[model samples]
Target: MKYITKNKKNNKQPRTAGEKKIKTMDPALLQVRPAMQESAGFEATLAFSDMPVHQLLKQNIQNKGYRYPTEIQERAIPALLKGADIIGIAATGTGKTGAFLIPFIEQLLHNKNRTGLVVVPTRELAQQVAEEFKALTTGMKFRAACFIGGTNVNADIARAGAKNHLIIATPGRLLDLVNRKALHLNAIEVLILDEFDRMLDMGFINDVTTIASLTRARRQTLLFSATINASQQTLIRQLVQDPLTINVSSGKSASSTVEQNVLEVAPNENKMEVLFNLLSGDSFEKVMLFAETKRTVDNINKQLARRGVRSDVIHGNKSQHYRTKAIQQFKTGHTRVLIATDVASRGLDVQNVTHVINYQLPQTMEAYIHRIGRTGRAGKKGIAYTFIN
Candidate 1:
């Protein structure tokens, strides 16, 4: 759980973690060379009116209605295209996906059948990124696959081997496939670690380290996080080469668009009743309620059903089919209330969610922010209420 960014120029100190096992490889296979020429300007300012990347890819970008680059995209994309190791620090919902996805897709388009590996913290995030990458590469006949938990392992391995150009996955499932000797990392030249901080927080350090070691040492490595503490910096240093750093202007606090409020109540005094009172209005439809445990989620769903409110519960213990159904009901308006635990916070990407209710406050402030982020997306106002006992 310790994240250390390898200082940009510092040498790695040898440490004993079991016996240090080293593998010898051909030196030629280990050298990762930049395929694209380096540029000095941001992609945002580049007058794409004439710059040639690929007429077809440029057309795809324009069709996506993206006329300008975000701060992270503006700074990071050029470096990424030049194949530099990069560490990007920016708040959530800042189009970090596009910053990497554009370059990733372009590489695939130009290089024909090359694979890029993207590692995330959770299954939802893996699916979300895969969807976004798929969208960007639309009309281009490149193949991509997602390898994450809650799915058949044999199915994923078969998909992974079928000439896919991109693999977006969570660390656990990716490492699982690696352990089974069902995945091939030999062809992957681009490796992106999105939400690098969350992976560190979720006890995925050892797994991520092992997965990263499988790639060519000189692969283009992109590390992104909301906040990069000292330890994460050290880890990045150890894992990547000299990485260009981009620090965007974060609001020095939680998301500015989200309206945060608190409600104090007794522990035994039906939190569901309090939730009903808060959600009594007609203006909110897409609502996400969070509790601290799977038992609490089930209890809340029961109370909501008793009150004639159609709701669904999602947690770790539920089958993947049930979890998917719960998410679908809330998303499609078949059921307006989605009850869940902290597990749904990081990676679910349903747009226009109007309210996020914390039936129970998270143990830490970071968890609180990520929970509320499920709503108020795509530049719309969202409300978050916390029930304190």
Candidate 2:
């Protein structure tokens, strides 16, 4: 029941689990070139001012200090604003949030009567999108109600039933409200599925399908994902109509801003020791550690706390309140390390995350990209290290 932790003062080595079964390494997975580099972008021909966005939205953009659009934003905004159903293929932190938000706000400004629904995969992402919406639509009389899990269902029902211009939600809670006749989607004009693939991965595709069907006649349908698989193509086709496909993702890699490498933990080597050494270094100011299961994430967080390290954890097992609080602590620098499973991998944006450590290998390269994508955001450089036993 003990974890291996290193004490540099004494060069102490602690006991760890027995040797794990060695799996064949995929060269393709190992060749994940960093794509977060500043130069690794599609050159934009138009600035924020040049786009046909509403003047107020434009001013709001300027107030936010957004001078130019990222490649995805630059290409996707115009189409989204033109009322085209869009499939925006872009990684997290590539300004994909703004890409759709700006144009959608503009459209709303032009016609306030139109209602919209933005469905995300996780509760954290639902909150992040809501905050971004609030920030971007400052001074505007836009009303949004967030219906995520981990809150009182009755309270959410009241809010969902109230008049709102937009409904930002997670699939489960939204469906619950819809089933209760608290939220009506028959008149929804815009439907946006952010982190589309993640939702599918979480087995929310059926729920998403139900939600999208309710808005079949919506004016616009926008789908955004870091990675898309062909198996989901049939479902995606059912979501959008005559959609303009836009892809700014750099194939498999996330960003050049992240320097990625792997570490080999010998049979007797404590992976915790390697992680501790990294965190003790000056470069890893704030770190996000990823494990494969809820138990592992909790174990690591508990061990770190035992060692007097400030860390917090979030996973599917945690309530929405705990997850939100954990993220808040990380944002306020109250926690040096935020440990979790792959739940935090998609659409969770925390600024200035200096490094990301994969305590164990992710099941797929896509998950690795998203995990590292948490760092190296907002044009900041980051480091990612994976432990291979």
* Model 2 lDDT per residue over 1-389, tens place: 01223333433334234214423236356744543345744567878988887777788888888888888898888888778999988877889889888888998888988889999998888998899899888999899999998899999987887789889999999999989999889999999999888899889978998998888558889999888877899998988877899877743656776777767665565667667767888877789999877777888888888888899999988998889999999999999999998889987999899889888778777787899889888667788887765
Query: TM-scores, in order shown?
Result: 0.82, 0.91
Q: Please state the error at residue 293 of candidate 2 in Å.
A: 1.2
Off by over 4 Å in 2: 1-28, 31-42
lDDT for each residue of candidate 1 in 257-355, tens digit (9 for 90 to 100): 567665655434554555676677896688999877777788788978988887888899988767877787777889888989877887787877888
The global Cα lDDT (0 to 1) of model 1 is 0.73
- Global fold similarity of model 2 (TM-score): 0.91
Report, for all candidates in order, the number of backbone clashes: 14, 7
